[model samples]
Each structure stands twice: as C-alpha cells, then as structure tokens.
Target: MTQHTDVVVVGGGQSGLAAGYHLRRQGLDFVILDAEAAQGGSWQHMWDSLHLFSPAEHSSLPGRLMPAQAGETYPDAGHVVDYLTDYEKRYDLPVQHGTRVDAVRRNGERLLVEADSGTWRARAVISATGTWTRPFFPAVPGRGLFTGRHLHTVNYRSPADFADQHVIVVGGGNSGAQIAADLALDGNVNVTWVAQRPPRFLPNDIDGRALFDVATSRRRALDAGHTDTGGVASLGDIVAVPPVRAARDAGHLHAKPMFAQLSADGVRWDDGSQSDAEAIVWCTGFRPALAHLSPLNLRRARGHILTDGTRALGEPRLHLLGYGDWTGPASATLIGVGRPARDAAHEIAGSL
Candidate 1:
C-alpha cells in the first residue's frame, strides 16, 4: 500500500532535516527521503581533512549548536556529520534513507512520488536538494586526451592524497586556491592554479563579519537584478579571501592562464602555456539536480529554480529550500538552510 502524507521532503540533508522538524512542530504528517544511506549528504563524501571555512558559530543549525573543540578555528566534515546525526536523533525526525525518488508527478490535487521502493502520495513536496548535486565540468576540446587522473574539487580532500604528484588545480575559487596551497605545502607536489580572471581578495574578517558576507551580498544582488549594469561586475562576485591572496603572494599559489584544452601529457592554457601534471583538480562549481522532477514544469533559469520566497511558481504545493538567495544571513551554510526549511514548513502548514 502506498503511504500518504501531508508533505514529502526530497533529500534528507541539513535542509530536509530542518524542514521535517518544522513540519512536525506544525503537527503535519511529513517524511524525509534521502538518496544516501545516511543523514549527511555531501558531507559524507567530502575528504577527511576538510573543515568548513565558516566557523562553528556560523555553522550551527536552528535549535542546535554545532559541537566544536576548544581553540578549533572551524569544524571539519566529520564534525558536521556528527552534528547532523545528533540533530536527527534529537528531533526524532522521520527520515527514510537509501530511498531514492526517481520521479514526481502531480495527480489532480495531490502529488505522486515514485521511487524504487514504492510510491508516496502527498499534498505538498519540498525540494531541499542543494545545488551541489551536479558538478559543472566545462567541455574543452581535447579534454579526453589527458592521460593523467583528473577529478573535480568535490572529490578532493587532502594534499597527502596527491603526495609527490604534480597537480594542476583549475579555477581561482576558494576551493581551488586552498587545495593548491595545501598541496604546495607538501613540498613534493608541483601545484599550479589556473585562473581565468585574477581573484579579488578579502580579509578573513570583514567589518566584524565573516568574509562570506561579500559573496552572500553579491548573490543577493544578482538575484535582485541589481548587479547587471554596464556589463561590468562588482568586487563581491570576483573577490577571494585574504588568506587566498596571501597564498598567491607567497608563491604557494601560482596563477596560470585560463584552461584551453587538455593534451595527452597535460593541460594547455589560452596563452599557449602548458603544464605537464600527474593530476588535475577542477574546482569550477556545481548546479542543482532537478532531473527527477520533469513533470512539475517548474520555473528555472540557467537550471536554477526560480521562486518567490518559499512559494514555487505554478506549483504552490511545491517548495524549494536552499535554491538561491534569501535562505537567510548564512543561507548556503548548514546554519542558513534551517531558516528556509522552517519558513517553508510554516508556509506549508498554513496552506493545509
């Protein structure tokens, strides 16, 4: 028999957990379905030594403080996973792990969610699956010719993984610069960073706020349609952290021209420069994974869901958390996702 619920939350990450908690608080029948076997999604796949750039104080979820050791600057991926697991246990949230939803369709007034196990009928659906579901790899000519091992930054963890190997880190984002710096410190790997444009660097603390504010502001501006004037972008969209800048200044992070193509031996740049490396780390970025919900005809641009606050256009019963800006002050962070979840849950409750 198919189970019926008031709401079905797709993706049981931090956002989904928070959504479930809020839904329960509102006394609504909801269930969280996750693709992974466990609660944490991307955190489970992250490298061992990975620590959140945001401090623990900024990483805490709603009603729960993220645990941290004394004098620890930031919490690692393990800490995040532990916290999320604890949060689930604390809230007694209903989560179905290892259950992947293959497709979702609207049947008159209710929605039907079909998975490998069975089907779920719900009055509402929340797509909390984050943007990192899809990795963005540019299609450069001759990319297949590279003989060396090439992987995206999502799969990267520590420099020890590439000990004594010549590594080429592509992109100028924080992830690329940090990975390159870590590898360069090993003193065995020859690290080169390929930057399409020189990064704008900011201090670790900006105006008593974390440097993430700059990026957050830019994201908000972009979403608000305020930064597209004159075909010239603002600094917030292009700047890197001060530590990244210091690394570049210290010669640990060497900037190469934009990536043009991949050859059998190494990568070729737009400036006719080439670097023969043992491995390539592409730190380009990620996009939302919405391939499973083709029946909704959801509004989107550049593959990003377009919604006004918590309400998804044409599908009010469908809500999306962590899609774009307005997730809160720390929207993309674990702490930030909770607010949207709560807000969306409240909105869903009011409708019911």
Candidate 2:
C-alpha cells in the first residue's frame, strides 16, 4: 500500500523540521521520513565537545526559539537534541522515524518515495537530507599506505580516542580547526594541523549569528540584482569559537602546509620532511546527500540539481532544501534554513 500526502519531506533534520513548520502553516498535509530512530538529526553524530558557533537564542528553527542553556553560552549537541525532540512534539509534526528512504521516482503526477518501511505518493517532494551522511575525504596520494588509524569528521567522537597519540589533522575548515583544538585542549595528544592554504579566522567577536546576518544581506543584494561580496565567508573561514580561540592563543592551534602525501608511518611534506604519527583526522566537508534522488536523473555538473529558488528547474514537483546557497542563502544552518523552507513549502502549497 502507498501512503499519500501533499508533500513528502526526506530527512527529519533541522532543514526537514523547518520545512515541516512552514508546510504546517500552509495547512498542507505532509509527512517527514527520517532514518534516525530519534531526534537531533546530524547533531546526534557531532563530536562530544562540539558546540555551535552561536548562542541558543541565535540558533533556532522556525516558529519556536531554542531555549537558552543554563550555564553554557553556546549550546552543545545534547542540548540541540533535546530541543529538536521537544520541538517535534510541541508542533505535533507527522514524522515517521526509522524509515529509510531508498529512492524517489516520478510516478505520473506524483512522486513515489520508496523507503525500507514503505512508499509514499506525494504531490511534491522536499529533499532536506543534509550532508552529514556523505563525508568527503579528498583523494590524498598514498593515503592507503598509512598504517595508522585514519578517520573523517563523521567518525570522530572525542579526543580521548586518540589520547597520547601524535595526530595529523588535515583540512582548513571549521571542523579541522575545532577538532585540532579539542585534541590540544585535551592535553593528551600531539596535534599537527595542516591546510592547503593558511587558515583565516573571523574576528573574535563574530559568531554564527553575525555570519547569518551578513549572509542575509548578501542574499538580498544578489536577489535584487546588485553586486555583493559582503558575506561573512568573505571575511574569513574559521569563526574563532571559544575553544578554537583558546587553542590559538595557547600556541596549540597553528596550521602548517598540507602534506604532499602519506608515508608508511605518517605524512611527508613537499620539502621531503617527514612527521611520524599514529593517527590522521580529515576534517574535509561533505557533499549533498542526494543518492535517493538518483532515479530522477536531475543532477547537474556538481552533483546538484539546478533550482529556481528551492524548486528544481528540471522537475518542478521537486524542491531541494538546506543543501547550501545554491538551494537558498545559508540554507545549511539551523537558523538559515527557515527562509528557504518557507519558500519551498509556499511554492508547493500554491502549486498543489
């Protein structure tokens, strides 16, 4: 039997929840299918010490504000989990937990969302499946030759796992900086951070809230057909979160040039200098999780679907939400996903 709804939202993460909120406002009957048995989405897989760059007040989904933590300035992963669980119950959003969507295919006028549990026929489908499942590990030469433990950001849980080991942290993104700082602060590991280029940190005062505001401004300007390069990303790559800042000030968070290749014991620089290590952490980012949508044949050059707003250019019944700016400005963040979610829901409602 195929269940039917106005819209079928894939993934019950922040993006999916945001879309659900707006879809409810539009009075459209919809269902959110989540692979996880519980709430928290990608936050559930975050490192034990991971904290948002912004305060709880600044990071929230649509309709409800995230409650402030008692003693923490920034909310941690556990807090986010609690909030997401409560938010779902508060709104009574129809979420089918433990349902893993296998594929999404066109079925005449509706979309057939085939899942392990069952299938859903929806007039519109919103792909809010954020990139957590698809961790990108760059093809570094001689990576397979390394005899030590190599892990990506997704596999990292805590610094204690690599305690007393000399660890080489790769990539210059926020994950690399934070993980390196986490290990350094733990005082149990010898951390050597490396990036392709020098790491750039935003002002100490700048946080996720400030970044979202700048992104909003840049988005508005771009939408109005004006030239704008005023996004927070233009200012820097790293957000100088407290842990990262502390590690930097303590001389424990400096990044060297990325190694040329991995050696049997560790990594070798382009200058032929070698550094022995027991482990390597790749903090590289992720690609969008769109494998289920493969049946649609809607992908473009960069494994992304061309979209006019959140709606797919080739398939009007499909909307890509919370992937990145191409889907909508800052659509990947907790607070940033709301606008695109609203637009996606609104467009789907109007079309329906």
- What lDDT does the true structure give each of the candidates? 0.75, 0.93
Question: In candidate 1, which residue ranges exceed 4 Å CA deviation?
Answer: 207-246, 326-330
Candidate 2 residue-wise lDDT, 1-352, digit = tens = 8899999999999999999999999999999999999898998888999999999989999989999988999999999999999989999999989999999999999999999998999999999998999988899999999999989999999988987899999989899999999999999899999999999998999999988889899989999999988687689999899999999999997899989999899999999999999999999999999999999999987688999999999899999999998899889999999999999988998899
Query: For residues 1-352, what per-residue lDDT tens digits would candidate 1 score against the true structure?
Result: 6889999999888888878888988999988988889877779888665567666777877888877746666777888888889999999988899998998899988999988778999999998777666888877788889998989977887787788788888877767777777677667777887778875454445321343455456656767889533211333322234445456667776677777888899977778887788898988888777776777787467676557676677788888786545344345667667777788888999999
Clashing pairs in 2: none
Considering every candidate listed, which one attains the maximal lDDT? 2
Compute the lDDT for candidate 2: 0.93
Q: What TM-score does candidate 2 get on C-alpha atoms?
A: 0.98
TM-score for all models, in order of appearance: 0.89, 0.98
Highest-scoring model, TM-score: 2
